[model samples]
Target chain A: MPTIWVYAEIDNGKLDPSSLELATKARELGDVEAVVLGPGATEAAARLGEYGAEIVYASDDQVYADYVAQPHVHALTELIGENAPDMILFAMNYDSRDIAGRLSARLGSTLMSNVLEIESVERAKTAIIGGTIIVDVALEGAPKILLARAKSFVAEPLEGGEATVVPVETTVPEEAKRAKRVERHEEAATGPKLEDAPVVLSGGRGLQGPDNFKHLEDLASAIGNTAVGATRAVVDAGWVPYSYQIGQTGKTVKPSVYIAFGVSGATQHIVGMKGAKRIIAINKDEEAPIFQISDLGVVGDALKIIPQLIEEVKSRKG
Target chain B: MNIAVCVKHIPDPNVPPQMDGKYLKREGIQGVLDPGDEFGVEAGLLLKEAHGGEVTLVSMGPAAAQEAIRRGLSMGADKGVLVTDDTLKGADALVTARVLAAAIKKAGQFDLVVAGVESTDGYTGTMPGSLAELLDLPQVTFAKTIEVTDGTVKVNRQTAEGYHVVECSLPALLTVTAGVNEPRYASFKGIMAAKKKPVETWSVADLGLAGEDVAIKQDVAGQTPAEERKAGEVITDDGSAAKRIADFLQEAKVI
Candidate 1:
């Protein structure tokens, strides 16, 4: 019987949510274990056992310390070679994505990136196909690579217990600089995470400059537990980061309720969030593409809509 | 600075339309090089302009996609290559990357490969990462800023929260973010020059990639019309607008 292996992501020593979700999903596959890469290898392995990993493979070598594409890819490839697990699951994070490709090639197995939804996995040979997912993929031969969209799957804490910890040192050549720590910035309030949030509030070029998003931020805060997203146009306008974009180019978030204010809803933008449960659009253009998919469309200026929407939320909650 | 930018032609999403049965009713809808791919081409141009090298545009789709190649040429690419074969339709990112990889290895002139984060339709956002894997090259996807000099390169990758800048070596792969560069329109002179540019077409046989190697495992299944939405009654009065706003939130389950 083949066991499921999860390539866990960790910062400092805490496990990333994606790795947790992967372990939870892997539960269905059979015995689920984790492969953690970080400084606190032993402690991280124990944490992984609590989360769901029956086994923890950790490292603290120079190559694995700082985040660099080459070293990480090399480490994952070597791990796969030794274990030869049937399936490998990675959270669709930057590092996971960059490494999976290398591992897939080195193993000659199939690689499916950014899988939004996973339907089933009974017989190892059952075929999987399309359903709001990027594509239906089946890993035919040996070890398989699956990069699950982290946000689509919900995360829950697992039973706490220290697991068997296995330590290893990753090797790097003399020429490598060992990717140095440069700069890191965090969003003011990402809210509950756009994917997990019940409500997603996104803005577009109608919101104007990058600073104008202050109103959006307030609106998101007023909505209390909602996440903030952005249209491709706004992201392209440099008003927001591409990660915040709610279009084809950004995160394809499907919240319970998606609200678009001052968004023109380009097709590319709509593709990202069209899966939301309920969509509401507020734009001056009655003919905007956002209106095409919005369940409730309000044609008006977004600047005005934001203030009014924010006030109404406060009033109702009061 | 020698760069390779992969381009794909997509249906104009701005136009209201869907696949009616098998063929596109394109009755009124227009088509254009995908906006994301335009960014890829533009990013390649910027790299070439800065590092003083050539930008090559590679298109793998139907012959109609030649327009995408011409557009890339118009964008200042030194050359163009179109890999056309009907069987290449609906190619999953994995197979598409393999096909491209074979062609890339054959050409053997690229130092950097750039592609849109995702196509307007497939929308997987995995090509750059996948291609880099096939070629065993280091990759930086969703790049906000990429500066290369000599053999060293620095890139800013966008994450959910803020931004992180990374420095790496050359011969890397990058899937650019949309805001990284504004795509310039093709000039009239460029368009004229594009007509004379050479675009190499490679088939599955020529590329040494079998249909099974590159064809999508699944068919589109089908495309349903986007649910129709109405612009509802206008708020005739200011007070009425406020009322609708309140009722809207209640109905939308926001409150």
Candidate 2:
């Protein structure tokens, strides 16, 4: 079997769910190994093993957290040079993309991003043109670098023992420590996260104005497990925070149900939510492209329909 | 402060894309400067206006890519350098970065490099990071705000939760988000002045790269249509539209 290494990420003393998802998928492909860095590497390594990572290369270095991506890149480059795995899978996020890009440049290897599925170690599948077409791509070089999109695979833990934790040692050059992250400002958020929510209610310019988002919030509250989302246009208009934006550049959500209000369904926005199990779009324009993929499309003013829908839902529950 | 801005000329996003076998058909489609890169151009121009230096646009695409460069020039940039060659037809992100690094080196010594968070067409969002690595420069991606003083660059880097205050020294690279600043339209006078700005076009050979050096590392085995989500029911909203939707939701067991 080919060897596959998963670049694992840690969040709040736990392994990031996306990393675990990649590790779970990697187990099906080959012998699963992992490389995790930062403050919680030791703890995360144990969890990674439960998700099918047999051997974990870990470094609990504070420098990985203090600086940007270079330290991790330096350490990973050295590790890959020492033990060349057939393929390395990365989660599509800020630090992963940063390290993957640098590693691909340093190794002179091809890197594929936004991968949706791994057909095999030699081939992968990706969506292009706003998720309208799926392309099967051949992985040409050894040590294939693939950045898998979030929510592509389900993470399942196996009944496994502790992995062999190997410490990663590399001298981080002074040049690599140039970019320093001084402070982090986490936006105050409540309710469920947009990505993890089962149902999502999204808005766009057709919502009329920013103040109308309160209606969406009210509906989400009534829906119980629903989260609010917005299109790039609405986010760019400052109607919502960047965290609430769902599209190509924003978060990709595969909720069980996605209900869009006034979203004209730009290709960028469609790509993010196309994987949703059911899509319901409401727009005034009958010709909006969103209707093409929507399971149920409504043509009318969102402003008039929202209040009535909210009432209807509340009355039925009562 | 001398600034270099990496830009891209892509097929207009407003137009539906057409596929030619494994590749996108580019010859017939209209091309425009990537909208995302406008923020980068605007950021560079704003810095040059304050710091009193030049803003140079660097790009790699077909000969038609000059239009993108000219658009940047018309926005008050100084000049442009475009690397266009047949060898770079299907160049991946790494190859593109290598070529841009070479062309940037040829352009001159720059204290800062700027680009968008991602391109509209490919949207890989990896070029700037790869280029920064190849050039041995510190990189700050997803910058919402940038400030420069005394050879240090400070940025508000956007993240999933919020933003991070990041600092790096000179000779660095940054990818600016759309929220960074408002991009200005080209004034008539600026458009006329752009015609006089010198633009240098170079080939891959001029950048000291052979065909093998930039060989495509991946191939498209085949392309198939994504599983279509069939349209189920459509209705124009009347007074009872909400009732109908609520019933549908109950049937779907989502409510």
Candidate 3:
């Protein structure tokens, strides 16, 4: 069987959930190893064993002591060369993506991101295309790289397995110290919680300005529990956070119900929300690309249409 | 200073997202620069152009993602690298970051690495912070503006509540939000320049990563499409349009 590797993340001795999911997916393809880095990774290594990692690769060197890319690169790259696993699994985190990208580029295999399921083990060589998720690509290669979204894979519990925690020490390049950690201030997320929200209500440049979102919000409020999003134009205009923008550059989501207000439907915007099941769009421009894919279309001014739709829904329910 | 920017090629979402069962069917779609990441790429290019340094666009997701890097190069990056390994297919956020970290280190030197705060397809939005943790790189997430002078970086960041300023040294990791700079479109000349740039390809082993290193840490619990949105019947023309509209809302319990 192929050896599948997952980048098991350890922070203060706890394993991150995304890594666990990658471990689970890796198990499907072949034997699994959970790779951990940093001083606290020992605790994380043991936890990974409990979760089902057949082997734990731990790197705790001065360079890796604090989570620098150079050492992790040194350790993991060396590890991949030594083990020759058939598959590599990683979460779609920032560093994970870069590492995967770098590795894939070096290895000459395709890296697929935001994957939802495993169609078949035979097709592990293939890359997944688009957000709707339909293909299992089997590339002709010894080892391939795979990236899964955090919540997209369902990790099953393993009966009983002890992961082999192996401590790894690698040399830290002089440049490793160039990047250091500073303080991070997290803001309370308000506008739209994309990952957790079931429905999303988005506004585009067609809305004209931020104040117009008041009406779009009225519709969202009527829907209740839906998060709000924006197009790049609005996000660039300072109407919303870059986090809320949806398109080629923004967040790609698969919501159950997505309502596009005043969006003239750019192709970039469409890629982000196309996975949504039910697409409802209201735009004065019926020819907007968004209308082409929308399950339901209302040709009218979004500002006018949204409030009226909100009122109509309220009146109907009452 | 040397900088690296990670970019991905994504299908245009404005078109019908072709699907086969649970898979997103990627065919016949134009791959373009992930608009979200364009901000990050633009940030890197502008910094390099102003600061007199090299900007390497690293695309490790898939061979297809190289297109995105070419787009970045056209925007004025110095070089390009594409890491293509099948093992990276469907990798979760953690492995994705690890692979990137591996590539960045092996690529030799970089004072900074920038990426879009989040990818357009994954929408996890956790990678930036997670990357900071993994890379141990001082980071500024959701940066709106970044001004670097004499190796000291000053940034205007977008918090969920409002914007804030952050200062840091060089050789850090940063996740950029939109408005870090208005991403400039590629002119014909710029496009030609990208073709003249160099693109290096690497593999998992080439970057010094063992094949069976990182394992899955979490499962994708479940994915339910956005909740169904019911469309209220349209009542147009006639004197009854307003009444019908009102009646629909009353029945739907909106008002």
Candidate 4:
């Protein structure tokens, strides 16, 4: 079997679940190995092994976290040079994209992003045209670098023995330390994350104004485990934070049910939420593009219907 | 200070994409400057206004892509450098970066490079990083706010949780996210002035690269329509829409 390497990430002593998900999926294509770096790499290696990583290359160096992606790129370039794997899987994220892009440039190889599935070592599936078309892309080169969208695969830990732990040692060149991260600010958010929520309630420009988002919050409260999302229009209008934006640039969600209030279904917004198992959109325009893919389409003013929907949901639950 | 901003001309996002066999059909669709790149243009203009430097717009695409650069020039960029050739038709991100890096070098000496975090059409979000790597420059991505001082650049980099305050020296690259700045529409005067702006067109050979050097690495083996979500019942509100939706939610077992 071919050997596949997963670039795992660790933050604040916690391993990103997407790494485990990729590791699990990689087992089917080839032997699975993982390279983890950051503060908790040593601690996260065992969990990676449980998720089908036969070998775990780990380093607990602060350099990976202290600087931007260059240090990690330095380490990964060395690791890949020493032990060339047939393919490398990266979970699409801010840092992963940075590292993968740089690594691809350094290696003079091509990197494919927004991959949704791996059919085999040679072929992968990606969505284009705002998730309306699914295409199988041929992985052309050895050590193919693939950045998979998060939540693309189920992360299931296997009952297996401990993996052989390998140490990754490399000195970060001074040039790689040019960009320094001085401070981190975490925006405090309550409720389930949009990606993990079972139900999602989204607002769009048709909601009329920013203050109207309260109706969405109320409705989300009535429906347990629901997170609020916003279209790119409203988010760009400063009606909501970037975290609440759902689209090509923002987070991709595959909730069990996605309820959009006043969303006109721009192609950008649809790509982020089309993966939801059930979609219900409410808009005054019967011709709204959102209705094209919605499981239940409601033609009406969202401002008029949201309060009633919130009340109906609350009363039914009671 | 000299600044270079990478911009892209793409199929208008408002128009639904059409497929020609396994590839996207770009023959007869309306094209526009990628919406995301507008923020980069605005950022470069702001930097130029603050630091007293010329902003050079750089792009790679077919001849029609000049429209994208024209839009940028109309936004206050001083000049434009476009690398357009038939071989660059399906160039991947790395190849595009190599071409852009060569073009940027040929354009002039630049202390800073600005770009959108990703193109709206491709949405790969890797161009700036790859370009920075090939150019051997310090890099920052997802910048919501940028400040330049003597020989140093500071940025408020957006992250999943919040933001990071990052610092890099001059001769660096940074990618700006949407909402970083309000992009101004081209005034009539600016639109007319853009006609006089110098836009140099370069081929792959002009940049000292061969067609084989930029060959695409990924291929679309096959394409199939995504499984369509069947349209369900539609109900117009006459004061009962909410109740029907609640019932539908109950039936779906998701509430």
TM-score of each: 0.85, 0.97, 0.61, 0.97
Candidate 1 lDDT, B1-255, residue by residue in tens = 688888887667566445544334323346678888888999988877777888888877777777778888987887877787777655656777777887777655788888877776555555666687787666766778888876866777776666677766678777887778888888999888888888888887898877457645433433333234443444323434545766766877678
CAPRI quality of model 2:
medium
Answer with 1 or 3, whichever has the higher lDDT: 1
Off by over 4 Å in 3: A8-21, A36-52, A56-68, A105-110, A113-136, A150-152, A155-174, A247-252, A264-268, A316-318, B1-144, B152-178, B183-255
Candidate 4, which segments miss by more than 4 Å at Cα?
Answer: none
The weakest ten consecutive residues by lDDT in model 2 chain A span A8-17
For every prediction, compared with the true complex, DockQ reads: 0.36, 0.73, 0.11, 0.73
In candidate 3, position A166 carries an lDDT of 79
lDDT of 4 by residue, A219-258 (tens): 8888888899899888778887778878766777899889
For model 1, how big is the CA root-mean-square deviation? 4.3
What C-alpha lDDT values do all the predictions have? 0.69, 0.88, 0.66, 0.87
TM-score of chain B of 1: 0.87
Ranking by lDDT: 2, 4, 1, 3
List candidate 1 stretches off by more than 4 Å. Answer: A12-14, A121-139, A157-162, A173-181, A187-199, A221-227, A241-243, A247-257, A266-278, A287-295, A314-318, B16-30, B208-239, B248-255
lDDT of 3 at A221: 73
TM-score of chain B of each: 0.87, 0.96, 0.86, 0.95
lDDT (Cα, 0-100) at B146 in candidate 1: 80
Instruction: Considering chain A alone, report the TM-score of candidate 2 relative to the true chain A.
Output: 0.96
Per-candidate fnat, comma-separated: 0.31, 0.72, 0.06, 0.76
